[model samples]
Target: MLLKLDLTDSRPLHEQVAGAIRRAIAEGECAPGDRLPPARELSRALGVNANTVLRGLRALRDEGVLEFRRGRGVTVLAGADQRARLVDQAGALLAEATRLGYSRADLVELIRRLP
Candidate 1:
């Protein structure tokens, strides 16, 4: 998955990194057992500090979406079950948006605007 960050975004860089990874998992762009890029490499790609990448990876690990193996770098732990849960949550979010008078297109547009 290619990680993208909006430098102008108000959120912290680490949070942005974590969010992109989470979205990748949710969208099935990443699967269980996939190995993530090394922290230093990812940092270089994202033009951020290695510590920032490490922080993002740690957050994913804490969320059970990734695991750090001794010699395997960070491996994805998210699988079909995780994807299903994400779908359910997204459904709930869409329902709420509908209740708030947002159309499906509106929801899609909003999501498209996300980094």
Candidate 2:
């Protein structure tokens, strides 16, 4: 999955990284046991620091959504249970977006613009 970044966002870059990865997982772009890109590569792709990528991956690991491994980089943690948890996470995000004045059309536009 690709992480399309918004450079102007007020949120920290690491959080954006984490949020994109989380969205990919939640939406089934990446699935159980899928390998994530290495920190340096992901950092380059997103135009952020390698450390920032790692920090975001670490945050996901702490949340039980990803696993960090030596040499192998990050991997999705989803099995059946984890997938269910991710769906809940997605639902919560969607609800929050709605609460914050995001319409379905807005989300569709955002996804449509992702590279």
TM-score of each: 0.70, 0.69
lDDT of 2 at 115: 100
Best by lDDT: 1
Question: Per-residue lDDT of 1-115 in model 1, one digit per residue for the tens?
Answer: 7889999987799988887788777777778888888999989999999999899889878767788999878988847338535754775798799989999899999999999
Which candidate ranks first by TM-score, i.e. highest?
1
- 23-70 per-residue lDDT for model 2 (tens digits): 777677888888987889998988888999889888888878888788
lDDT of each: 0.82, 0.79
Q: Which stretches of candidate 1 lie over 4 Å from their true place?
A: 80-115
Clash pairs detected, candidate 2: none
Worst 10 residues of 2 by lDDT: 78-87
